[model samples]
Structure formats: structure tokens, C-alpha cells
Target: MYPQVLFQNRKPDRIATLEEYRKSGGYEAITESLKNRSHKDIQEILLESDLLGRGGAAFPAGRKIMTVSDDAPYPRYVICNADEMEPGTFKDRVLIHADPHMLIEGMLIAGYAARAEKGIIFIRPEYENAARILEREIGLAEEAGFLGENILGSDYSFSIDVHRSGGRYICGEVTAQLNALEGKRPNPKQPPPYPTEKGLWGKPTVTQNVETLCCMPHILRNGAQWFKDLALTEAGAGTKIYCVSGKVNRPGCYELPMGVKLSEIIEEHAGGMKNGAEFKACLPGGASTRFLSREHYHIPMDFNSLREAGHRLGTAAIMVFDEDTCMVAATLNLLEFFARESCGWCTPCREGVPYLKDLMWRIEHGQGEEKFLSMLRKQSKYLWISYCAFAPGAMSPVEGLLNDFEDEVMAHIRQKRCPFKGGE
Candidate 1:
């Protein structure tokens, strides 16, 4: 177990009501921010804390706050990106469901800092309970003078709308999310005029993940140094909600410090492997991240540590695979999801993902030849030509297959069938 800043005191088997959350000293950050602090002050604190985005990319959240154009003709917008579509990623779902007001209060502080009058919670439709909880909490906040006109009798005013996503993985991408929110076809638009510059309806917008925003209130209440000291690593700040699944005795989300070792998370936190199963490899983060072998288990699970080890801390969703799991079959299963979720906007992602999936399926089913293996490897390399991160992320499992599990895949080819057939 590690620090539980996010989940501490959370009620088991029940969603935290607005009253309960408020009673627990919630909304104090936004109240202090609006009544006494300015946007620049908030931004400076965040910058000092070095809190990276909790979304897959791990970008700096404060940098996004500072870059919004206040002089833009249109009102700036803030979006709470709750589109948790990445496979094995459900921490956001838990956050929204248990402590919806945490996200709401966090958004209020974010909107205040960005000078954003309008905000949107872009929640995935699949998370019906979380969406409902958030919607109800937004109303409660409005009635309590935390949202809508003249918040806390001050000049600052902000309102939030919860929008159910159209159920595409692409919508998790900020630009594509803006497009979908604007009632356009969901697709990733090229960057340069990034969301901070020109976003929803061509207005400057700040989009942050649900967990990233949830950290805002704590940073405000505890101060930047306190937040920085909470991390176990030099650069890492705050706690990470690790969603552990697959072959683990404890298959659920655990809030751990940033630099907690992977081995601790897998063995101690996840209660070791289920039924004494030997850990073969893990996605470490979500499906998009590169796999980490048991040898890397002693390393810290921070952004820099994982990246230094040639992997990403994607959404911090740890998916462990036991020894009996077939690497080739697992790779194919992930590719099939990517192929189905492709937005079909560009040829590389639209066509390439499905083609890769087909190749992997053939190889998994024992129809693979040397050329098919070569094509799988080559296609994984070139899928980066796609419009957005989708295709490249789709190829992550393939990357793991080629790099760490090549012998496992070779066994499939040699056996002329998956070695672990009928045994995922």
C-alpha cells in the first residue's frame, strides 16, 4: 500500500455525495482561488509542483494552463477529458464514480486559472454511472454557488456541461474530442494550432484528463512543495492511481506514490500473481504502452523511469500477463481493438491497423509464413505514418511481440498454430 491522497477516506460501496465532499473541505481550493488568487498565481504554483498530466502523454498540465490565449475573441473553454477508452484503464471511471465532486472542484480551479467561462466533461458513454454522478454533482455545485453566474458572490463565473462521448477511442485525443463536442465527425485534426491555441469552435481551450484535474485541488490546498515531496522520485510529483489487472490476486486500482517500484506494485500491492502464476511480462501502463519484462520490475514506476526503460507510464494502468498467456495471441487481441476503434480518418490508421490485425490474426491462428511475420514487424514500424497517435499506439503490442516475445511468436510459426490455443 502507498499514499491514498485521491482515494483516502472515500466511502466504500457508495458514491460520495456533494454534501459529504463539501464537508470534507472540498471546494475550498476553488473558493480560495476565486476569492484571493489570480490565474497566474495558480499557474505558477502548478509549474513549481511539476505535476505532469495523468493522461497517457504525461505532458505538463501547468504548461497547458499558461498557454491559453486570454485575448482571443471567443471565450476560452476547459474540458475535463473523461473519455477513458484505453484498454485496462478505469481509474478515471472510479474517480468520477466515487468522488465526482473532486473532478468538479478541480475543474472549477482549472477554469478559474485559464479564465475559461465554459467547461465540458467529455465522459465516455460506457461509464453511465460516473456520468450520472458527475452530472448530479455539477448541479449541486451550481446551486451551492460554486458554479454558474457570480460564484461565491464574486465576479468570477463558470459553468460546466457533461457530454457523453460517441464511443470512439479517437475521442480521447483532445482535437478529436473538440470536434465531437462541436457535433462534427470524430477524427483527430492535425496540430500546431494545438488545443491551447485554437480548440472547440476555434476558441482557445484547455483539455485535461480526469485524474490530472483531480490533482488540482490537492496542489492548491497543500502547496507546491508539499505536493512535490509526496512523490518518491526526484522529478515525479504527487501520487499515481495504478489500475492493476490480469493474473493478479488483487485486480483493482491502488493509489501509490509516483516512484513506487513495479515489483512492489505487482507483488505486494497486487498481492503477487494469482495462484502462484509466474509473471511473464506487463504492459506497465495501459495497452498503448510498451511491455516490461520481470527483469524491469525493480525499477521505479515514474514517467522518467519508464521512459528511460523504453516504455511509457500510459494512464498508469498496469496489465500483467502470466506465463501461460500467449504473447502472440495477446498482441492480436489488442490489435483487433485498435482496428475496430480506428476513426478511419487517415489511410495509415484506417487501413493499416486492420491490415496489421489481419496479419496478427493469421499468425496467431498458425497461417503465418516468414513474409507475414516480416510484414507484421514492418507494418508496426511504419504505422507511425498515421494522422494521430492511434495507429502508433495500436502497434505497441506488435512492438512488444517483436522485441521481447519474438521467441514466443516464433514458436507459433514453428508449431503452425498458437502454442497456447484455447488457453488465453
Candidate 2:
């Protein structure tokens, strides 16, 4: 039996109604915590669970909650970061669309644990259906005495709100998200004053990813020990919804236990490559992560395992590429996305990504030279070392392709055209 925390409904398209969700023990965790536990006690349970943020960074969620717990007078706030903007990452939307009430219940539990008085779910604009579903659910929760002013007749009170992002990738970053919520351009700011200290109109605020917040209700319902036992590895605890896409036979979101082998995920869960295609390389966690070849397919899918295998497990989105695919063309497609999504705040990202994209295009078209390749490599290095994570993420696919698929690049250079052309 799987933990009811993640897949309580179990149906692929089950959007839990407020009545159905409450029947399935949805608000029981929040009610129990609010009635019997203190803020410090809740924080202790979370810390014991060893729950790391499900967002790309994989930071400790309990530590983040503690940072904002002791400060503010009253009315501390929790923000659910639902801005699922990472390329090839679509699991958050799946969760929201399937069970928005689960997220609402989880956010309510987090607000209680953090002693926060207000909560906001910042969803991306492209997820219009998710936004709508959440909006309706929040309205129902509010009317039933679960959301507004006095929850379950306790002295503590919390309110929930929903805001839509303007379809920018940077809005997924914590600092930039704060800026967007404040009616400013969504650009990242210096982090000496982290969001825990001064966030959301200068109040104590803690922001968590949609998936991260949704895990809270389950952690509180089942003891921390039960949650820890769910992991397939030591470094990561709990199941993850891995989003597999691009050239795979089964391109969809999978709820697999952590530390499952990458090869198992591909060959079994994802049904391997499409057609008669042979695997060439894969970006283990979306376009932001580096490429891994057949040798790395045996690596476990946990964060630490992926890191040791030489890639960050970003959002657990694995984009597979077949042997017939051109690395140069694939990299160019990623660069195009990054360049278009850049906030243009810093020079390196604004100028550097487009420059790299242009070079890749020329190379794909057979107009590139050895000198152009060398220059592109140097520029990629510079961009990786630039201001924020945006540039570094943008540079990853290009650098990875060059390192793992150099022969493909050389094939493009020598053949004066794509070798995959005309199905040959």
C-alpha cells in the first residue's frame, strides 16, 4: 500500500472535491496539529522527517520553516510556489490538476506549523485550469471554517489567497517570486535579507514549492519515522513524481520511490526509447542538468546519487535523446527557450544565451567552424559563472552536449549538414 499522502485518490484525473477530500482524512492532520501541537513541536517533527525541498535546490524545508518561525509578531505568511516553469518539468501541474485540495490542505498545515496567518498559492499563467481548480477549492475551504479567521475553533487563524504568475521562468525563484508578488518586475535580488526575514511586504514569510508543501499534510498525519521509511535511499526520503519526456516510449509523470535505478525508470516505467531508437544521452533533470550516457543509466535516481554521477537532479524531469538526434540541434532548442525566458536583468544572460544560440544554429546548418566551436565553449564557461542561476542553467545543455556528444558536433562540422537528415 502506498502512503496516502501522495496518491490518496489514486485515480489519474481525480480532482478531490472538498467533501471527498475531508472524507479521506484531508484536514485531520491540520486539525490535530492546531489542537494539540505548538510551533516548535511541529518544526521538530519536520526536521526529524528529513524532508528536503522538492524544488530544484533540494534544500531542507524544516530548516527554512524554523528560520521564519521565531521572528514576526503575528500574521506570518506561507507562500506555495506553484510556478512550474522549468523546461521538461510538468509534475506540479499534474498534482494540482489531479488534487488541488490536497495542496490546499497541505498549505493549511504548513501555515499552522509555521504560525503563519496568511497563505498564497502563486501559480503560473499557463496553468489556467489548475488556477481555476485551486480557486474553487479555496473558496469552499474558506466557507467551511477551514481557511479564514478561527480554524477548528482554535485561537489561531489563517487565510489563503491565489495569485497567477505572468509566465516568466524567473518567477519560480524565491526572491524573484517575492518581487513579482510585490507588483515589481520579476527579477532576483541580493539574498542577505532572505525571504524568511523580510518577505511579502516586509513580513516574515516562508515559500515552498507546490510539491514540497503538499508533502506536509502526509508527514504530519503519519509520524516522521513512517515518512523516512518510504525512501529507497538514505540521502532522499519519500517518493517523487518523476516527469519523463522527449523520445521516450512513455512520456508522462511517474510516482516512483526515491533511489530507483535510472535504467529501471527508463526501461520499465518509461518503456524505453520510441520506435527502434537507441539511447544516446539523457539530461537527468531537465535542460538545466548535464547529459549522462549509457554508462550512467545504472545510477540511482536520488539527489545524492545523481550528484555523484555528475548531474543535478533538477525537478526530477528526465529528457531522453536517441542516437539519431543531433546534440547541436537539441542544445540550440534549449538555448532558444532560455534566451526567450530571460528577464534581461544581467548582461551575461541576456547577451550570452542568444550568442550561444546563434552559434549552435550556424553549426546545425553547417556554417560553423572549429574556431566558432571554441569561442562558443569559452562563452558558455563565462555564462555559467555569471550572476544568477539563470545563466548557469541556460549554459548546461550546451556544455553538456559538447562534453558528452562531441562526435555529433564534429559530425555536423564535417558533414556540412545533419547526419540524421533523410532518416539516415
Error of 2 at 302 (Å): 0.8
TM-score of each: 0.98, 0.96
Per-residue accuracy of model 1 over 1-424 as CA lDDT, tens digit each: 4667888647779988888887877888888887789899999998888989998998888888898865765588999999999999999988887888889888988888889899999989988888878778888888888899999999988999989999989999988999999899989899888888889898889999999999999999989999989889997899999999999999998898999998899889889999998999999889898888878979899999999888889898999999999988888889889989999989878888899888888888888877777888777777888788888788887887788988887888789998887447
- Candidate 1 positional error at 51, Å: 1.0
lDDT of 1 at 93: 89
Model 1, runs deviating above 4 Å:
none
- Tens digits of per-residue lDDT, candidate 2, 1-424, equal 3444576665665686888878877888888988899978888888888888888888888888888847566668899999988989998998887777789888887787788989999989999888888888888888988888888898988888889998899999898899999999989987778778788888888999888887888889888888888888888788888899988899998888788888888889898889958888888887788887878878889889988867888889999888777778888888889989888998888899999899888888878787877898899888965668988988888888888888888888888877777222
CA lDDT of every candidate: 0.88, 0.84
State the displacement of the C-alpha of residue 256, model 2, in Å, after optimal TM-score superposition: 0.8
Error of 2 at 367 (Å): 1.0
lDDT of model 2, residue 52: 82
The most accurate candidate by lDDT is: 1
The reply for model 2, stretches above 4 Å from the true place, is 1-5, 422-424
